[model samples]
Target: MNGTSFDGLTVVTVLYRSAGMLAETLPTWVRSAGDLPVRFVFADNWPADGCADVVAAHLPADRYAHLPDDGNPGFAAGCNRAVETVGTSHVLLLNPDVWLPDDALARICAAAAEDPDTPIAVGLAMHGGEYVGIDLNPVSLFIDRPAAVARAPLGPSGGAAVLPTALYRRFGGFCEHLFAWGEDADLAFRLYAAGLRTRGLDLVLPHAGGHSVDGDDRLQGFRAFLLARNRLLVAARTFTWPLLLVAVPVLALAHVALAARRVRQGLLRPFLRGVGRGLVEGPGARRQWTGRRFGFGSLLRYLTVRRA
Candidate 1:
C-alpha cells in the first residue's frame, strides 16, 4: 500500500449484466480519471454477457483486469472480490449505472491526499436529480431512500464512495453474507464505530439508478428481502449491546415503514422471511465486526453530525 501516494487509486466496479451501460459510461470514467494512475478493475457478477469485451474495447490491456465470478454472487461479494485486486492506496467503488463527473473522481483522490484521516471520501449521488449523500445512519440506508447525508444524517450512496484500501480491509470489506442491500451500511456502521468519519465531497454524481436489478424478473423483490435482512445483520455485526437496545425500536419502525412499501409490491412474504433469516444469521456475523466498537454513547452524539 502506497499509504501516502495520491497518485494511485483503484476504481472497483462490479458488473451485473451491465455491458451496455458499461460501454456507455466507460469513456467518461476513463477521461475523468485522466493521468491519475487509476487501476480500473471490473468484477463481473454476470459474465454470460461479456463485460470483458466492453472493458477490453474501451481500455488498454494493462489498465484493467477482469475478475469473472458467476452465480450472481450479489453486489457485496462482487465488491469484496474486486477490492482484492486493488493495488492503490485508495479505492473508489463505482457502479456501472453511474455517470461520473469529469472531475469528481480525480478531486476525490486529491481530497484523500489533503485529509488523510477521513479514510472515506464520498461524492454525493443524484439519481434523477435528487441529491443523495453518504448516510451513516444504520437505519437510514435500510429504508428505500434518496436522502443526502446532510439532510437525512442517515442515507449513504454506496456507489460513488472512496476510501483508503487499508481501512476498508481492516474493517473486513463489505459483509459478503449481506449479499446486497445493506452491506454498505454494515461497513459504514463498522467504520463509524471504529472512530472514522466518512466525508462527503462537494461533487454531484449522476446515477442511472438500479440498471442491473430494476427490471430483472429473476431478482424481483430480492433487494427488499436483503435490505430487511441486512438491517438486522448490521445491527448485530456493528452495534454495541447498548446501541442495540436503543436502536431496536428505531430500527423496527424503519422496518415497518419499508414493509409497507414491500407489501405494495407484493413482496411481503420474502420480506418477512428475510427478517427471520436476519435473526437466525446475525449472531454469527456479529463475531466478525464486534472488536471495532469504541462506544455507542459517543456514537449517539456523532450520529447526526459527522464533520464533512
Candidate 2:
C-alpha cells in the first residue's frame, strides 16, 4: 500500500466519560493528521461530559465532526457508528485515553499501504513511554497445548489500531453485544479469522493504562467474569471442533484454580460467583461468526507484517 492509494483514511474515537483525556488526545491527533486527508469522528457515549465540544475546539471544522451523542453503546458498537458515518476507505479506531505522537498516523498509513489487501495495522501501545505488546489470546484448548498458545500473545490491551473500511464491512466489524470488556481481543481474533492479520508496531502509542477501575486494581472479579465468558464465546464461534473440545474444559479448570487464588487473596465470594456466572452465561452468549473466511495463508501473511 502506498501513500496516494491509501490517502483517504478517516479516524474515529469512542469516548465514554473521558472529557479530560480527550482534551489532550484530540490536539495530538490533529497535529499528526496534518495534510493526510484524514477526518476525525467522535461518538460520545452517555454521561459524555461535553467531550465532543472539547474535541471541536481543537480540530478544524472541515476535518472534524461531532456526531449526536448516543447512549452507552459498547466500544465496538460506538466505533461502528462512527465508521458508518464516515466515507473513508480506512478507519482508525483510537481509544480516548491514548495519545499518539505527531508522526504516528502518517507512519501507520505508510506501513499499511505496503500491503494491497487493505491490511489492518495496529500500533504498539505504551504506558508512560514503554513498548507494549498487542496480546492475542489463543483458543482455550490451546492452553495445555503450550506450543499453540505460544504462537500468539495474550493482552492486557486496547490502545490504537487502524482498520480498512472494506475489511470492517467484510468482517461485520466488532460484536456489539460484548458490552465493554474483552471486545478488542474478540475483534482482533475475528480479524485473524476473517483473513485479516493484526500486528503490534515496534513504535509505542503513549496511553494512560487500564480503564476498568484503578491503576493496579485489575477489576479482578469483573474481568475474570468477562474473560471467562467472552473467551469461551469467541472460541465456539471461531475455532475448529477439535480445538474447541480440548480448549474448553482445560480453560475452565484453570479458571477454577485462578479463582481459588483470588479467593485466598481476599475475594473468595466474588471470584467464585464470577466463575459460576461465566460458566452459565458464557456458552449462552454464543456469537455466530458468518463473516469472511481467512485461512492459514492469511495468518502467515499477518505474521510477516511484524517483520515489516
Candidate 3:
C-alpha cells in the first residue's frame, strides 16, 4: 500500500463555498492520495470564495486538476462535469467537508484494486460528533413516520461513494436535472434496480456535515420539496411495475406527512409544486432510462439483506 503502485482511482469532489474546510481537510487528503499515487479532480463551483487559493496553498497546481467554473452549477452538475474528464477505472465522489484518515485512501484504493468491479462502496461518516452509518434507503417510509422502513442494505454515505466508471457510464451517472438533492439516492436505487449491490465499509470518513450549506434554514423548505419530489422520481424510474405499485402509495403517504410539516414553514407551495413536477416528469424518466431491463427480484435481494 505504501508503494505508489496503486493506480486508476480518481478522487472527485465538488467545492461550493468550502475554502475554510478545504484548508483543514486538504492536507490529509493530499497525503493519503499521494501515498497511493491517486488522481484528484476538484470541481470548484464557487471560485470567488478562495477555493482555488486553498488548493494552490496545499497541493501543487499540476498535481491535481482544479477545474474552476464560475457558473455555480448545482452540486450534481459540478460532479458530473468533473467526472466527464476522468480516465480512471473508478471514481470516488468525495465531499469537501470530509477528511480521510492517513491510510484511508490507500486502503480504499486497495479494495478497488483487488476487485476492479466493486459496484458501489461507501464509508461511514461523523455526524453529531459520532460515527453514523450512511442513511442508506431506497425510498422507505412508514408510520415510524417518514423514516426508512428498512436499513438492511446500508450505504452510499453522504460523505462519499466509490463506484466503477464503466457502470457509472452505463447508468448515465447522476441525473444532472436533479440539480442537487437525491442524486445519491437516485443513483443508488438505479444501481439496485440493475442488480448491483452497495457495499458498506467500516472505514470512517470524518465529515463535519453541513459545511457546504452550513445547515441553512432557508434551505429547509427547499430540501423538503426535494425530499418529496425525488422519492417519486426515484421510485418511478427504478421500480418495476409490481414494485412501483407497492412503493407509490407509501411514497404518497410520506409526501402527505412532508406537506403537513412544510405548511408550518410556509413551504407547502414548493412542496406541492415538487410533487406535481415529479408526477409530470416521472414517466419521461422511466421511458428515457428503459434501455436496461432488470427483474423485481433484484430490489428485494438488494434491500432485504445487509451487505457489509
Candidate 4:
C-alpha cells in the first residue's frame, strides 16, 4: 500500500514440516525487511517438524506470528488460512524453502505496487542456485544464475507471488478442492476468467523442490490426480456446456495417448488409475458426464468448490 512503492508488505508462508529451512530464510527477511511492515507468518499444517518453536526462536515477536491450527491441511488451504490473517495492503505467499536475497522480497512488492490496477505479480523461482524465468505454456521457472530477469506472461508459481489482498479475497483465494498440484492453474484460470491480469516479475528466489513431499512415494501420481481433476473443473466452468461436451472427447483421447505412452514406459498403471479416480470424483463428473451439478447453479461457483 506504499503507493506502488516498497513500504508496508506482509509475507505469508505455509509450512508442512519444513521448519529447518525457515530457520535460514526468516533471518534473511528480518535483516532486510527495511522500514516496510513484513510479517513472516507461518501456518503449521501439522507441526510435525516442531515448526512453532523453530519459527518462534528465530522470528522476532513484532515481525512474525504463528497461526493456531494443526491438521496438515493441503497447501491451498494452508495458503488461504495465511491470507485470512494478513492485514497489509499486499500479500506475498512464500514457501519455506525459498531463499530470498536481502532485498528481493521488498523489490517484488515495490514492483507489484507500481500499478494500482495490479492484481498479481509473480517472481522467478530459482532452483539449485540459478535463476529461472517464467513462461505460461507448459509452465517454466528458470533457476540459478546472477543476471537480468524479465517479466512476461507466466503460468502461476505459488511461491513468492505478490498480490493485493482485495483481489485475492474476491477470487476467494485458491480453490480448496485442488489440495496441491493444480491450485496454481486453477487460481490463474480464475484470475483470467474474472478479467484480471497476472504478471511474472524478473527476480530469482531459490526453491528446494520436493523437500517436503517424498518423491519415491509416487507423489507425482497424486499430483497427476489433482491436475486431471482440476483441469476438467476449469474446462467445465470456463466453457459452455456444449463446448465442454465436445472438448471431453479430445481430452479423453489425449489422456489415453498419455496413458499409452506411460504404459510403454511401465508407469501407466498408477496414472490410469488416478485419471479414473479424477473422472469419478470432480465437478467434471456431474457437468460433463451428466450435468448433475450444473443443474440450476452458477457454473463457476459450483465448479470452484468440491472435493476433486
- lDDT per prediction? 0.73, 0.61, 0.69, 0.61
lDDT of 2 by residue, 56-173 (tens): 6887788876775566766768877888888877777777877879898888777656653444434443433443334433433212111122233322134466666776666667
Q: Which 10 consecutive residues of model 2 have the lowest summed lDDT?
A: 141-150
In angstroms, the error of model 2 at 67 is: 2.8
All candidates' TM-scores? 0.89, 0.78, 0.85, 0.76
The segments of candidate 1 whose C-alpha lies over 4 angstroms from its true place after superposition are 1-3, 136-156, 304-308
Count of backbone collisions within predicted model 4: 13
lDDT of 1 by residue, 49-153 (tens): 988988998789999989988887888888888888788887888889878779876787778878654555455445455544444444443432334434332
lDDT of 4 by residue, 1-308 (tens): 32433345678888876777778776776766766667777778868678888877766788877885677678888889888888777788777887778878667666765764464444444443443322222111111222233333323457666777776776678767667765665565555544454555666666776667655456655655555555556555544456557666777777776677667756676666666666666564334322122221333442343211
- What range of 10 consecutive residues in model 1 has the weakest lDDT sum? 146-155
RMSD of each: 2.8, 5.0, 4.4, 7.5
Highest TM-score scorer: 1
Order of candidates by TM-score, top first? 1, 3, 2, 4
Q: Which segments of candidate 3 are over 4 A away from where they belong?
A: 1-6, 129-155, 263-266, 293-295, 306-308
